[model samples]
Target: MTSENLIKYTQLFINNEFVDSVNKKTFPTLNPASGQKIADVAEAEKEDVNKAVDAAKAAFSRNSEWRKLDASARGRLINKLADLLERDITQLAKLETLDNGKPVGDSEFDIQCSIDTLRYYAGYSDKIHGNTIPADGDCISLTRKEPVGVVGQIIPWNYPIMMLAWKWGPALAAGCTMVLKPAEQTPLTALAVAALAREAGFPKGVINVVPGFGPTAGVPLALHNDVNKIAFTGSTEVGKQIMAYSGQSNLKRVSLELGGKSPLVIFNDANLDEAVEIAHGAIFNNHGQNCCAGSRTFVQSGIYDAFVKKAVEKATNRKVGDPFGDGVQQGPQIDKASLDKILRLVESGKREGAKLETGGAQIGNNGYFVQPTVFSNVTDDMTIAKEEIFGPVQCILKFETLGEVIERANNTQYGLASGIITKDINTALVFAQSVQAGSVWVNCYDYITPQTPFGGYKMSGIGREMGAESLEGYLETKTISIKMPGKL
Candidate 1:
């Protein structure tokens, strides 16, 4: 189907129906590829958030149909949702590419990952049972895992569909109802997914999707008193705000997978070609609009010069243009604002005396496309080195020792992900163990799987997102004790 045909739903998805905003207001969503209007989606605000939350709260009630459903039934519904997503992968990927300006292939990859994530959590639905413990003094004790109830999940613009699955998977598995506020920039696919959820036989008020700006829709969802938990995946600044909003309102459980300026350490013993390719993809994938993009590349000085040369060649050869175009390795940086931020950091890198290896300019006049930028002889204190330059800019820094590089890698206040590209198992093991980040890749970078847990350390934010471990954030463990003499 064509892109126009895929623009089927632009309204807020609440209580299993698509409806206009309370005030009948709408906002235009732009296509970052051509700087043109895709469609005007329903702009959800405080009232919308309240409406969605009420629906979710009702769904979580003790006698609600959703809560009364069996765990295996929940799993069946989740699998059905995954099936729908997989069936409509092409349409959703095109929609995602049109809205978020990522390559269609990457969007397709995201949908597959989302399906995998959903299926993974679906299997966990029946498996998430309570454990009977050996209690003291003739008393039987056990722990029951119950849903947190009425969760508010705010996903980021980058990887919209993937983030939705990441949050919805576990929460649905645990039998929790939710109101999700998709990023205003890329809300169309989310609305589509919510439609599929209804088709998958989810009860009304079990899931809702509202599309609006952060202050209007996002803030209300996070601060809603009825929301038992708030899960956010975005900038560290906004993550802090979500935490504060939870505090100001109900002290709700907050799970944040925040920003990162992760480092990739390349030892001299590493394969030069492999290291170059991995590092290139690490920072440049998704046009570098990634939370765990390895922004800093700390190369051991022995092979640093050679790696820099090959890296410059790789960056120079990358094609940047329309995400829908063929042979395009890089796309525009989400929007004009993101493009401007990347340009600002690129300038900072130049002014700080780093060698501009290649590519540091805007590619076109219409879209928000940027050159695949590379810099060598970068220092730790440079703006490009320190900040999470979520763009196609690579900063290659030289280091002397493993000890020194490990310290340098952990120097940042943010530690979401880190990587080591060395053949030495000893070096890789030590680096993986010593890294402060949540997920440390040994030979690869940004190696995320549905089975593996992913999150950050320090200012990168709190809590995990994927795997069985993420189920904890969505559930509350309650201990039950009974006297043996009280048995019937």
Candidate 2:
């Protein structure tokens, strides 16, 4: 196929145009579905990162046309960008599919979500209000919400496009210039997004993208003194490192959406068919690479066997092949390293005495794919139950009562998202209120809207994204209190 025919792959986008890297270092982004090299992307070094940051800093400091534009003008620009995205949805979706190993249709849906997010945040820009404090004397006092200047946004490989929206939608609407570092594995869509923004008349240096490995580009961006705020979506380990760098370097404001071993609980009262389908989606969608994959399932023992049997049967029937191929439900891991980590976790589950019910081996020859493994009788202590596999692996554990299940689910170090499937309204309400997760899905999994705030609790993450609160995270609150000289 010609390069144009391939939906994914781009060189680089920096400062409102496609550009070449200064280092002349290039890396191949692979199609995970077939383990085939898709396209060569310019590898950005620390100097390149510095350049991007400097450009963003300059843009933010200049009070340029971008800043001078009124809130309505900013909103219009974002809406126009959204319109451009919708106009070329297919191309963007195809690029996401090829690079991220997700189905094209799903990629399109993600693009739609991105569009909605931008529009939502755009509407919020003018509405973000300052609070006027009632002063004791004849002084004017108010708090204003202003952008934190230059932002360094680093997105993870899984759901790269969506995560980018989560970071940039609010940051952009808040009038912060941003330097984006997309995960090396999935830079194609990000590059496309940068192009769209430029086409929509965003000023040069308002947004820049540099695709490179995390340790080099990501690290420097987080630690750069010029970067006033850092927003990241990735593992907790990396989140910690970002925090450490931010503390040591600039004391920058940091927002992270980290890893999760989110739990899905199905009570005996749940409609079996509905529960089973949502359960599969919770765990297996995106090949189970979801940060909130619902990896740990707590099913009521009254219907545990039936649930597990149906879950395995459905997963086994799922088509696992090339992501670009029609009807394929699952794709390969992002790379070999992720595949190996998943396999080791599966083995650890077996060693820990969890019953390996079905599917636990590499499936294909060319790509880093694993079978849709399911484990039953999983204890809370099992590695599969604790650590994030970031693959298509499901571990189901039985619980007798709500108390027991809730306890087991919250016993983890991470609390990103949790799901409950119960026909009883009271039960659903209880679980929703009591669960320690950031989001509790009832009767569904992976359902997200642009207006709702999403993030995590505890080690799962810090700060919120995807809602008006996200704008707050990108801004600084300052209180101006003027003392009254004559009244007191």
Report the alpha-carbon TM-score of model 2 versus the true structure: 0.96
Per-residue lDDT tens digits for candidate 1, residues 249-338, read 999999999999999999999889999999999999998899999999889999999999999999999888778889878878788889
- What's the distance in Å from true for residue 430, model 1? 1.3
Q: Each candidate: what lDDT? A: 0.92, 0.86
The stretch of ten residues in a row with the least summed lDDT in candidate 2 is: 1-10
Model 1 scores a C-alpha lDDT of 0.92
TM-score of each: 0.98, 0.96
lDDT of 2 by residue, 1-488 (tens): 12376443365666776777887889998887778888889998799888898888878875687778888888888898889889988878877887877777778888899889888988877887799998776788999888899999999888877888888889888989999999999988888888889889998889999999988889889999999999999999999999999999989999999999999999998889888899988999888888888899899999999999998898788888777778878777788888889889889988999988788899878888889888999988877888899888889999998888888889999999999998899988988998999999998997879878889999999999887778888888889988668845
Clashing residue pairs, backbone N/CA/C < 3 A, model 2: none
Predicted structure 1: clash tally: 0
